[model samples]
Target: MHSLRPCLLFLLLALMISAVPVSAEPPTVMVADYTISPAVLQPGDVGTITAIIRNTATTATVSEKTGLPGSGAFESSKSTDIGVNIESVQLDSKDVEVISGNYKRVGSIGPGQSIPITFLIRAPAKDGIYFPEIWIDVTGGQSVRQPVPVNVNTQIALLKKPALTAIKTVPEAIGPGDEVNARVVLRNDGQSRADQVTVIVNCSSPSITQKTPSTFHAGSLLRGENTSIDMVFLTDKNAPIGINRVCLTISYVNPDGTITSQDEVIGIHVRGRAKIGIASLSTDPVRIRKGDPVSLVIRLENTGTDNANSVKATIDLPFAGNKAAYVGKIEPDNDAPAVFSLQAGSPGTYTYTLTVQYEDDYGVQTREERLQMTVLDGDATGVVIAGLLVFLLCAGAAYWFLTRKKGPGNA
Candidate 1:
């Protein structure tokens, strides 16, 4: 029984030990992928970044290194995409340091099957070209590498640009807070499609939005062909009155895989910075007898967005002698009419012109219209003479009959 008791104790101890859970080993890791949104920027600019790191069958520290600088004009911050050991932001242009806390690593690119990390990169303030690099180091997994480009031109010039004649505004008289669409038409004077081209349009108003691509290829555009982009300028509620200037830059790819770029400037006029005006005129058709007089009326409207001073209206008068009656100013939502009388001494179709002139705070405004009428004639003078002769003959006959009968019956 004592021997059985010792065996029982041993069995109990073994069962207790078996019931305990075993410890687990950590996971393996690797950095297999990375992405950069807008991998390019100008000096003193910033970019958004994304990265992936993975752990393989073994646990280990994952380290990443960005593409190192190749020239004095080009470089990247180890802090831009560096590990803990190298934690400093770098740039090819010296001015990038002027902006504090612009670029940094968001989180540890720790080891895993694959983990994503984000970052911000700041461009140097100076002008030049820079190629950024990213390198991922895994204890057991293969190293990953990526390169980004930063084209900094203190000159604000695009890399490859195309030729532009001009950028014009559609309605040059838009006030603040008004919606406007401006267009830039470019012809591929070069022998390319204008691929990979970047177009930048600027307006004095920040409310404007351009729909064209930031970059494009010149080779993609054919010669004698034109491509246009629209920029909607949202007027500010309180914009200054006067002329607003708009600037444009075009960067394009050459057929030989080279890049060229160009720039242009345009302007728009705002009279009141918030007012608009409209002018209209209309005419009617009429007929007249030869050697007779005819009259007609003309209607004028000041369908204006604002009040206008010294408004005038004129209409073309037929070749015949004509006179016009003056009409007064037309109020908003109202109209004015003028009457014109003409003597149609001829038998041909007559055409007339009407001109309207007015002055406002801005300047002089004019409008024109045409008037048409026909005059009929059937040998008008001869017909009237013949009718008078016939009437005289009938009068003579009647007078003779009455005179003879009265003479015979008279006492």
Candidate 2:
């Protein structure tokens, strides 16, 4: 019974100990947490930080000043007596003294409370990962800071190797006074997006009259985006319509930021030929006596890439005499008509060959065209007037003879 009492007493003492109220201790004031808004950014992207700082000291620092180390800080966030000031942010390698106007200073962070410090930082240009280092100042000549990490990237397009989707050339052949058209669509096949891409095109044996915009604004061309361009060629009558080839180069990119370019050839068959039919001349009636003036007309057209420079177009009427005029330069895409007159008053069917010639880098090239001219038989229509005058003179002689005869009879 005595042993039981001791055990009972021990149990009662344990109960009493358990019944005692436990005083909760104050939470340790220590800041180990930080947060950065917008976990990602690009160059010139602004960011801010909200720091939860817990002051561990049971008592507050006498001085309200607090801040991180470093100079050239421009702005400060609300913080301790020593506010946090962030200057212009710059890359450390940029050999510049300071970047200004980045962060602002704020009041001090209190004990067992969280303090938010804001700072701004710029990003570098590239496609890789990166982050910024930051600090916060506190009282007692001690500063606390938390490094916030952020990812930086770009959304710009790049021109990489490009492929062609559609290629078309119009009018395989054009006669001496005609035109041709060609078009091609470029497609981006790589994985990088393409912007402001231009295709430089060159054509052989053909002159370009009209080309699509000299530059192609790919406009964020993603992989598989197609852009089209056009080219026009005016074939000269002297042009040989057979086969012409042009070269095209494309610089393009895809969505993944890869760039590429390729040069390609487009083979076009030139087919049209220029034709010059004869046009009528003035003065159809034939005057078969002396040299009379005859007018000749001819049409000149640019049927090729070459132009007629200081063109002297003339009609060579066989016997009547040849005539020519100095027509100004005519471009391949247009036409000009030349007129000249000659004198041929002979009585024979005359044929002459009129040739149009122009100067080029290789010297003069000529176009000789043949046409038929004729003169008809002349009539007494030329002598009829002479006979009338002779008759009038005879009338006067007869009247005088009659008057003499009558006067003698009367006498």
Candidate 3:
């Protein structure tokens, strides 16, 4: 009875152990810890995120059913597989952008294995606290997500340079001794705002000077905002013609409490007013007979701000000697003379055209005036004496005939 009792107890323990079902343990994968390079970042700063992924799953073994060789009986074959495969990785945040290596593939991980995954990210433009969500997708398993906290320090504001342009000028074209009004446009083309902006004009040339205050102050300028400044400038009376350059200095304070300065150049064109005219025209002899020599004189004047160079005068007449004369340069408010000798032709009255041409700073100019000349007959005195003698003889004859004829008729 004792031996039977021992056998029964052993059989009961075997049955109980065989009745329990056997199952394989599942894989466990998670993110253990993470590290960030340059934890504190400013707006538009680039940073890197590195995460440590650990697989805490033990080796899994499964049994596969196989048929026995040449027999209907079946046998069990044991097989072992390890680790979990990671399908993809992603980062989520409106303020952050993934520059590179966003989605990555980790083929498989063994039991008790850890791997590092890296990602490149850019910070937001504004300064504040941000939380970027990082997610890892596992093949045939649940997805893992983690929230990463980032501190954005924006006490030091970013600075953007301002743009300066010349919008318009009151007088499109300017002359010497003329006052010009110029409008300058300033625009903030950068992402950051500027404070306490100022502009100064530097007239390095002696020909130009500022008529009003040379400095202008603009309180604040926001991104994409624009403003204008009006300035007056006076050009010297002796300023030369062509293009002139002026320098402008701009200074502004940034949000970081720093001063920045920049220099720009502006081009201004200066043209001188040029005027030329024929001052006077005269002949040497006031009265002249036929076939007599006459001398002609012409005077030219420059009545404007620019000098007249290469002055010349020409006479258009029937009889003349050396018709053209060189008068040389005539300065502003100055005159030059040209003389020529001419022979008179057989004519009662003659008219000539006196043309004066000159080159000035602007261009070539010409002026024409009428010239009148009179010529008398050489035998005018002799003919007048002969006619007087004939008239006296005829009057004497008529007086004697009248007295004699009256006596005869009375007898």
Candidate 4:
């Protein structure tokens, strides 16, 4: 009975060990990518190398179980965290000198997480390509290592530069006292990414004022990424009539910590508006008489900044002669005359309409003005009265002469 008791205890220990849960797989880490600043480093120049370390595990917790088959001692599945602790990160120098020390006890990384590790390094005094290896150690997991290529004093280009382009949208033609809406589109056309991009805009003429802020900040632009900025401007009523320039200053930081600037120009066309007015109205003769010829003159003036074309004037007076006149073109701050020849109508005051037509930047326009004129009647009754008085006087003189001659001689 004593010998049997010892064997039974051994069997109980084996059963307990078989029912214990164990991990099926351990967490793993890897170096996803790496970058070196100042791609082409001169001999003895210090630069930085950055690597992205990521955890390959996809889930936060994994189900695990272990048991002896058909022993009726099966264990339920248990969950375990797949987090990885970064023990240390070091850069092994081959032909380059590591300036920054290795990283120790960084922290834990959750499943599918990534972190960037950077180290300062100096190039050796040789004109060739060098390989630098980066080692990342994980606690209770496999270590990760990757080799990065560095260019030292060689003509080979290792880093791709960032290139940016600007596209603008503006109105084809804008007039004074108009609101100008504009847009600028920024695009990254290079292989690398651009950071901290800023844009500033200004107009060349003082007459053109900005309605919004001139500065815009675009945080970051990845490869083949794009952004847009909207801007507004207000033009003065008397702004210059011509092509104006809008200057754009773009600045951004490259991946190598270098600042780059670009200057671009866009044009805004300003068209002039023309305004026409009536300067004066008069006639060639001071006063008009019935059955007489008269000339009516109307002076047209331009007060705006552009020329008025195809100018014509017409009068609505009840006359028999020409009533329409063509003045051709009138320039800004200038005047032109339209003359109409007509015969005087009747006596008393006569009301008429003066219609003026012209073409300007805004298209065809017409204006009407009311005016009045006076005409005097003709003289005919005074001539008949004078003829009757002369006839009576000649008869009296003949009778007196015949009586005086008969009394003095024949009696």
Number of the top candidate by lDDT? 4
lDDT of 4 by residue, 197-274 (tens): 999884457888788898899989999999999989888877777887888899999999999999987677888767
User: What TM-score, computed on C-alpha atoms, does each candidate reach?
Assistant: 0.28, 0.37, 0.50, 0.49
Worst 10 residues of 1 by lDDT: 78-87
Error of 3 at 229 (Å): 1.3
Q: Report the Cα RMSD per candidate.
A: 20.0, 16.1, 16.8, 17.5
The CA lDDT at 305 in model 1 is 39
Tens digits of per-residue lDDT, candidate 2, 136-199, equal 4433345544444455554332234434354554554444445666676666655545665767
C-alpha lDDT of candidate 4 relative to the true structure: 0.85
Clashing pairs in 3: none
User: Higher-TM-score candidate among 2 and 4?
Assistant: 4
lDDT of 4 at 75: 47
Full candidate order by TM-score, most accurate first = 3, 4, 2, 1
Q: Name model 1 segments beyond 4 Å from true.
A: 1-31, 56-112, 129-186, 189-326, 330-411
Ten contiguous residues with the weakest lDDT in model 4: 60-69
Candidate 2 similarity to native, TM-score: 0.37
Candidate 2 Cα misplacement greater than 4 A, ranges: 1-98, 101-105, 108-132, 140-143, 149-275, 297-312, 318-322, 326-338, 345-347, 357-367, 375-411
